[model samples]
Target: MAGSRTRRSSRTRTTSLTDHLKLPDGYGRPPEQAGPQGLDLARRLRALTGVDEDLLAWVWYERSKYTALGGVVLGTSVIAAFSMWNFVNEAIGEASVLALLPAVVWLLFVLNLDRWLIAPQPNAKRRPGPLLMRLAVALLLGTVIAEPLVLRIFQTAVEERIQEDRHGDVDRLRGNLLRCNPDPSQPDHGTPAGCGSYLLSFGATPGGQSTELDALRKDAAALQKRVDQDSHALEALDTEVREECRQLIRNASSGLLQRTSECLRLRDKAAEYRSTHHTAENERRLVRMNDRIGQDGSRLTRSRGTFLTARNAEITQRVAQERAKQKGIGVLERMQALEALTADHTALFVGVWMVRLLFVLIDVLPVLVKFMSHENSYDRLLSARSNSAVKVHSAAVHAMERESMADLEIKQEVTDQYVRRRKAESVAAHREHVAAMNIRERQTVDSLEEELRRPSTV
Candidate 1:
């Protein structure tokens, strides 16, 4: 009997629990059933994305959430990997560790970037703020990161163009060299004046000059030497004539009283010698020498100045050409070459940005298509079904709570009634027991009195 009572209590508790938790049938299913066409579309989307049907019904009612997520993951990965590769290449020997830290941080940032694309939906209708912000960031990053790589991709073409430019420079330099030394027969031809045999030295006998220049220089030097000798000769003659003439005058004056013919003849001889050597003849010769010297000196000065100026100019031009040739094919040099070859900096700028824009558009395509597409019939049905399920679940919980409260009130009333009755019964029994005790006490007292009276009779 005890075992049977225990089993009965356990069964009652289980029944109550089930009744409390159970919901109405067909609560989660749609009130109006979907046709075959609607079901077919849902099935196709499920197969394509591989999302669970229940999860699709709840969160991704309009589109394939799985496909969208997969695309974002793939694109982000590709972009991150490409960016990291370029960073490593640039910083490998310089600051490998420092470069890697930023690359890792960027990778993490990009991987979690889907949050910006997907998180703004309070409902299906409002546009997401994060989506716009993300697209702008993507475009900027693409431009900065992709430009150098694109330039590198076309390096072969750039190098070829640089070669062509180099050849042009060399040809121009050679032409300038020819202009500096025009004579084909001379050793200076086809060479710069600084390096040519004709302009190796300067002065009366400068090297590597034409025959006419050499003759002119020699004539100028000879005239200069002859003029120096003539000047010294003229000075000596003047001094000798002055001394002889003074001596003649002194002799003639001393013998004035005698009036001798010898003195007179000596004076005449002095006068004749002075006139022959120091007067008109020598003076005329000196004047002629001066004129010739002046003419030759000026001619030589003009010729020398013209030649040196031309030669110096040619030397400067040649030096500049050599430096241009020596400019190596390094990164900075290559960039300069590219600029020179293209010539239009504005066009290059526009082209680089256009490439970046294309990449940004490609990266954001899947996100835009998924979010911007219109909701279909299957989505509406799924949303309705989910709403109905939620309502039924809520109703079941409320009903269970109300029933529990009512049952608790009835149990409380029954317990109170039973307690009152039991109290009343106990009070009545106590009153009767008190009355009986009083009666017993009175009888015992009477018996004691009668016994005392009988004892007296004995």
Candidate 2:
């Protein structure tokens, strides 16, 4: 029994010895050798790089499954914000609404846009590497598309508002001018439209001064009155003369005494001719004189007809020329009138736009305040959130510990036996003192030498 107990005690001691020799599950048999300060150094490097769990989480989130949803939410938010601005602006004025578009767009780009849309993959091959690069490219493209839209909306809204005010002002001015009758002597029909806004506003008061337009207007009125009077007198004189000529011809042809005298003279002439020794010669002479008179009368009648035809043709030609000249003049006058009106319209538009621009500037104040407050609130909320650093450290430490245990296992199994052999081989290589480039380095050197040979200078 004493032998058995002693044997059992020996067995227990043996087991305890084996247990002590065996490594813990995680610690490999030989244990890993790394710098004691490795974790501390890693932490310092991370701190220096300003890389942390929150940043990594954000990056992962951006690149992860939620990316598209985030984009949609951002886009929806932008649209909703703009809608709300419009609603509020309706209560105020349109000019303010006009200014809000670009301002909101600016804010979207300046703030939450990148956070919402851009993926932050910092460990990519290139600087600013993959995710952010894609976001930047997307942003540029978006700007190309959206900036113009914002500008157009702002411009159209502003223009419409300005035009409304200008139209109202024009109507008011026109009405006021119509009510205030100018002096009769004033040109432009004493109307505001004709006088134009500038001239009306700045012209001397009617009581104090007379302008060239006024004098010219008076002269034109007097000339028109005289022309009317002369035209009427000429019409009456023409009628009276036609009546007198008809009456004289009628009275002369009807007088009985005149017809009797003419018959007596013709008979006396016939008897005288019969009593003469050369009555045939006298008759022939009388016939010749009568033929001469007939010829003269026929020539006079033809001449009168020719004169009438020429006069009619001249009148027609003159009328046609006058009409063509008048038409050309009318066309030029109308073009001038249109140009003047266009200038007036342009001036009015410019003035109205200036006022609208001022109003827009004022309207932007509220939107600016809202944007500022939103930004501040968002920052405060983010600050209130818990830090993720502890979680990050735990994961990193777990990973490192696993890697260390694996490395120690590999070393114990294989590397430890080979390390001395590797060291001896390295010593032997060093003793040989051969300085030779590797195949890749040799090729690089050859290329560089070739380049140097060809080049005059670097």
Candidate 3:
């Protein structure tokens, strides 16, 4: 009676547990009341969760739950793909046909990843280690997935900020280059006293031509100085001679100027000065000096022009290089601009974070749902069904192992019996062989005794 009661209670418990898994009578029959076609799509989706569809189909809630999780994976992947599209587009500087490749690849990868994260496992509660590892992975992926979407949410402002920043950099770089490489056409005050930041070792510095030109100009000026002084001294001597020659005593009546000794002396001195200057020779010397000065002047002009031109050219090239360095927009720049936007405005900060967390939540929804949900009817049914199959398979394996063991034991008995029979046969053969040897020895001894008796006769 006790054994009967135990068996009865076990059946009762099983019936109660599996009652929900059972369909209504005739509900699963074909032609009249067929299976739920609505769950066909759900079954396909649930396949991503790596479940037994035949088993899962019986549990409607499990099918719905897993199907929803698969949708989340697909939705998260779409978001990820969109974010990737923006990244690729921004990096390439325009919409690119190639952007679709990376987006599609990333979408598939994220889809697989989220599916793996949400996939069901046996005894998940008992294994905290694997659960925690999956959680960590999901969180890391969430963060990665959230950022690009967050930036995309504020795309307009972020893009504007990025452009503004790039232009600002161009201006700043141009200024630095200009400061470092002073143009030669502009008056070079040399480098400003503390222009350390902008100054470069190589720049549009005026060359030795300026210094050489200055020296040439000074030489030209020196040449004219001696000629001017000689002209001045000769003019003074001529003036003295005229004044002495013109001095006249008032003659008694309409008297002409009389010859004066002082006048004669002045004339002689003027003649000596004229001889030293030598009108024709002095003109020749002045002409040669003027020509040399003109030549020097022309060279000075060319030197200045060349210096300005070279310096200007170098400044243009360097400024252009600097400007190029500051010109382009990129993924990193957009990210940084987003950060700046958030920092500058409280509204933006709150809004941006809200969007970020929303995307992260979306990305990790499947993981969170699987991790945090309490076990429902679906869980119990799946566990019971799977566990039952496992136990049945395990029982079959044990039965095979026992059958193998029995076969091995029977083989062992046969081998032992065969060995015992062989041992008995060998013992009998040894006894017979020993008897035969003893008889032969006795015969030898008798023959030797007879030989001795015969020898005595001889």
Candidate 4:
């Protein structure tokens, strides 16, 4: 009996296990039970993610789901790392502890981004928005990541171009300075020295026309001195004439008016010395000297103006050159050079993009190929098997319901029969009791009658 009980208990446990393995009424059977192909596919999918068959079937259609998702995540990580590296490289020149924050954030974003790319939704129609957004973000990120690396890889050429740009800037500044100076002989002309001293001295020293200006100034001074001497001689002669006229008038007396007139004429004649020293000739010489001085002064002024303008221009050019030198080539400048280089070399740009696209395709290919392929035979078989399971479960439920209804009817009929029999028995028992009581009462009446008859005879 002990052995039998143990065997029965083992059997009950096996039955319970089998019952547990079976699907619920509405739920489908395992894909493996559906067919060999579905079973094979289920095993493959199970091997891929190490998830149970039921859960896998509910989520993914095939093994490619795993491959595609993994590929997307892996590719996103590669691109994101490079992208973050590039950003950190350009922003701070070298990586730092602070840079790691953005790197970590970027990595998390990339991981989540993959999920965002392939996140499941109930409606297939609304999926394109998310898919396109992911693609756009991936493309943008890939471009940003690829551009800096590509440019860095070609650093030699880029640096060379930058050096060329610097030289060009220097040459431009030099040309501007030369144009401003227009005179090479000046100490400050078209040179840093010239520019430095321009404001202090007004370019007055060692200029091209310095000697000529000095000579012209000296000539002007000499002419001025000669004019002054001529004026003094003329004044002395006028004084002598006035004094002689007064003396004549005093000597002639009031009656001799004609003598006074003669004396005035004599004084005028004495003043009129007729040599090269004559007042009229001296005046002419002074006028000639003044005209020459004016011409010399005008020429000197024009020459000075020219030199000063050139000096100012040289100063401006020098200042600009210094500023440009101080601001050297930077990241933006290098980037601009790369852009121009790419424009000039279309093949290079194309090659770089092709490499980037290759990486992107590596990431997205699994998803694209899986989705684009026709429905798998396993999937179709599973669907059919699920439908059949549902139908069978529904039929079994209906049959159980019918059996339950039949059992209920039989139970109800049995209960009614039992109730009726009990009521008949109860009624028969009550009738018998009444009959017994009537007999007893009759007997009692008979006895009483007999006693009364006997009593009357006595």
Candidate 5:
């Protein structure tokens, strides 16, 4: 009885294990046993509940948005990556080193925020609070994780500011080299090669840190001093030019006034000439002379007036011409002087502006150089952040790939199994029908043989 009980218990365990192994076949083994009503009800059920359908549609939309957002984020990150690589390329020169941090940070922020915002989860629960709380927690976690990176970002910014200040000095020196006191003797310092400053500044060997930086500092200071000197000289020149321009303007004003007086005199003289040369009075006098030709003291008076008027007109015209000539000379002289003054003033102002720009550029060069050339703690931090984002993106992609493969495999296996089972059933049915026909044929053959064996009375 004990052995029997053991055997029965073993059977039961085996049965249980078998049941466990037989997972739901999904389809094709047998239709689920159901009452007619149950079957009808199942058939009547909507493919999707309204709310579920809407939610699913929303999810689809969200998925599309998420995909697009992810692509944008990834694209931005790729650009940042290329930018970082470019920074590495320019490592020899400080021109664009500091340019990497902001781009990296921005790319990270976008990628992280998008991922955090769209992280998938079991969304069966409708209550917004738990889901929101979960999302908030995730965001907080992401931020916490990203805190060191943020610090690095801030440090990069500060370092950039410092480097910019230093770069300004370098630029100032460069400007001085180009301008006054330029050593035409010195050969041009060829443009620095790739982003080598970082490698040079932070190499495997720890030698002469202070000495190097101090030298850099000294060079910057010298450049700054020179910039200040140039700026001051430029300012003085500007002031002097302004004063000279003002004096010139005053002189032009005096000349302009004299020209105006001459012009007025010329206008008056021309008017007098026009008045004296009256054709109407002359014509009237001629008419009287003709009418009284033989005996006319009246005709004699008119002729004398006409001769005096012609002489007055000639004298007035000569004076007007002289006055106009004087006025034209004065106007030309004033205009020429005024134009020279304006040109000189313009050139002076332009010179001052150019000098100021050079000073400003010199002052910022060091800082720009430092930020652009060297890797701060932020670069590592941002790199880590980028790696994390990449991992997440990669995991998602792998998961999707796995799911697609699994789906295809399942479909193929189901189709193959179904086809094999259908072929087996068809073969069994054909074999049974063939057997039945053979049995009938054998019985007919047996009847014919028996008849042939029997004796024939006729």
Candidate 6:
């Protein structure tokens, strides 16, 4: 009865061990049995979430939650793709199929990036160094991804700002051109201050037509001087004649109101000088010169008008050309416009940063979620299984080594035995061959001896 009791107690212990070694409730169960909703999708999306679905299968019913996380990762990739497409399009200043390649590349890169960032979990203890590094990388990627979306959100405003900048550029160009291409004759146009650096010189202007006018003015001045001198000489002569004829002064020797010889001689000489050179012809010549100057001045004014008109037309053309260059509104331009828009307004600055932070958080969600989570049922199971596998592998390797060593010893013993047997057999064979040769030699000697003993044959 005591022996039977011991046997029963051993059986009970065996049953307890079996029970303890059995799998958990979820393990070995079909995915469909996980919940009312199957885990089929959760299994597939495990690749996106960077979680092992096979390991996660035995976990608590977090399939739904992880599936949603996987969806979030996918959504982030889509957002990155869309943002990249727009970024390329905006940079080129147009939409084209060529932008699709980069968009697809970015999508894959971001998908993989999120997976890498979220997938790797510490075996037992969470190391902050690696986690922090991953978080930093995710934040950097998120920051890079946010700009394009932000630009898209403020697209209308940015476009308006770009247009304003374009117009401003055109205005500045026009002002510079006008300044640099000043009308030479019009001093009021002033110097083109600081315009040389910008290369704002416009127009192929001709020299002014003021040469003839200037020459005519010089001639007029000379003629007027001559006419004045002639008139002054005539007036002086007339005043002397009046003084002698009207008795205002008399010769000191003649005290009478008689006509003085000297006065008469002077009057005669003045009349001769006037007859030879009169002021009337000189006055007429001066008048003709004045008229010629006026005509030349009018011609020069007309030429100046033509030059100014052509110069203005060239300036307009230049301004249009400059505006054409400014028409390309690219990604950089939009970013600048957004920056300018946000610089002054406090509310807008806050709103812009908030949107950017929201996008960053969205990108960082997968990492953050996994980081905050403790080791789940799957992790524990994987750890236990991993330890078990290591022990089994080590044992197998040790067994293989022992088996190999035994095999080598057996082979070595067999080879040594074979060599010893072969050596003995060869020794025996050599001795037998030597003995046979000696017997043959003895037989010949004995035969010769018998022949010699038997006499006759030489």
Q: Candidate 4: RMSD over Cα atoms?
A: 16.6
Error of 3 at 191 (Å): 7.5
Off by over 4 Å in 3: 1-33, 36-39, 49-63, 89-101, 126-133, 150-206, 219-247, 250-256, 259-290, 303-330, 336-354, 385-408, 443-458
lDDT of 2 at 101: 72
TM-scores, each model vs. reference:
0.37, 0.19, 0.67, 0.43, 0.22, 0.72
Best by TM-score: 6
Query: What lDDT tens digits, residue by residue, belong to model 4 across residues 273-354?
Result: 4355465665676677667657765766677677667666666666675666645445687788877777889987787667
| lDDT tens digits by residue: candidate 2, 107-177 | 45532543433222222233344445554444444433332233334444444444454456555544454
By lDDT, the best candidate is 6
- CA lDDT of 444 in candidate 2? 94
Clashing pairs in 2: none
Clashes of 6: 0
Task: Answer with 3 or 5, whichever has the higher lDDT.
Answer: 3
- Which 10-residue span in candidate 2 carries the lowest summed lDDT? 26-35
Off by over 4 Å in 4: 1-54, 57-61, 95-97, 122-134, 181-331, 356-458
- The residue ranges of model 5 lying beyond 4 angstroms of the native Cα positions read 1-352, 355-373, 399-407, 439-458
Cα lDDT, model 5, residue 48:
12
RMSD of each: 17.3, 27.2, 7.4, 16.6, 36.4, 8.2
> Candidate 6 on 186-284: residue-level lDDT in tens?
545556568764443434432444655666788899889877887788789888888877764555787755776767877997888776776677788
| Candidate 2 whole-model C-alpha lDDT, 0 to 1 | 0.43
